[model samples]
Target: MAQQETDERVSDEFIDDTKDSAEREQAHRERGTVRPITVVGHPMLHRECRDVTAFDEALASLIDDMFASQRAAEGVGLAANQIGVDLKVFVYDCPDDDGVRHVGAVCNPVLDELPPDGRVLDDNNEGCLSVPGAYAELPRPDYAVVRGQDATGRPVTVRGTGYFARCLQHETDHLYGHLYLERLSKRERKKALTMMAENTPRYETVPNAE
Candidate 1:
């Protein structure tokens, strides 16, 4: 996920960060090896990922690699397919509108339906690590909740509002074979692609095979 720069950060009094979450994120990064991010034209990015049925050391290593990749790309969130893994998994270290940081990995994530009161939309500039240097304004619910399991197979629920909510939705979309570019109009999609072509990404990327 791309970070938006705004002078006014959303102030939510209820937002809080936990020590366990922070420690877990750090541990993953320390153990992870950075991998190259896949670009837009890669076939792996276009297919729905397989559900994660195993919660073993491999899954744990994948999560660690995801965090490492995300940080290397300077992104807030990343899906498995972004690094050539075809599994329903994503990792995030995103900050909410209030600037409260949240970190965790979700497996086989299922996004919950929003209630009537929580349907507020925030049309903010959204970008993807796969898409690289391009960004387009996309409207998404300001609040979101995702249910899934942790690396250890323990059930976990993640909720966020504002920027973090956008990260949850964006990363979940990637797992489902969807990209933020698909949500844009034809002209806007082209515009984003053009921008991508003009700007060289700062990080290494895995190019699609010819």
Candidate 2:
């Protein structure tokens, strides 16, 4: 898969040791615009999110909030459940390996394919805002196509390859209450559990607090 174009860091308050670490940290501190990302063990993260059946002002507002929350958390994409909503909705501003931008909001999404059923990854590890401080080698298709509606109920189909594809599938999994950890082998799952057990909360509120 191609690399993802992201400036948003997954971990909360990470000190980027790049050339402008100080500048980046200062900006993040000033922004303070993040939403509470949900973590594993939250009941909502274990249940399938409901399909978005209502397209109204509330839906629009929710999408906006998710966008804000996602940017605040420095994420490439985010699902409604990630912010603690039960609706099957997600938003993204990610990129393909070639650095082309692909962005959108998808509600009530259906995947065109799934892992163990498509092209697989062996070397790449995936992270979750929900499963903070944990990284696991979870295989997913290198390409992804997701079909759903926009906030206004207009039909939308999105196709992505590389990191963008991975973003789509990851957010879709959140809609179904499936963490990347679920895709891990038993040994990896055990290690992820250990990581979660040793970590602290990433945000002030539960991811589902909304």
Candidate 2 lDDT by residue in tens digits, 1-210:
111123221112311123343353344334434567777878888889887778998887777777677767777788987777788899886777787666568787777756565666645778888877778876667888777777787666777778888898999888887889888889998998788779875555473333
Which digits, one per residue and each the tens of the lDDT, describe model 1 over residues 1-210? 211133221122332334566787788898999999999999998888888878999999999999888888999999999999999999999989887789888887777778878599999999988888999999999999877767876666788899999999999999999999999999999999998999999898998842
lDDT, residue 81, candidate 2: 78
Count of clashes in candidate 2: 2
What are the Cα lDDT values of the candidates? Answer: 0.85, 0.72
- How high a TM-score does candidate 2 get? 0.77
Cα error, residue 74 of model 2, in Å, equals 1.5
lDDT of 1 at 3: 17
Best by lDDT: 1
Model 1 regions more than 4 Å off: 1-17
**What TM-score against the true fold does each predicted structure earn?**
0.89, 0.77
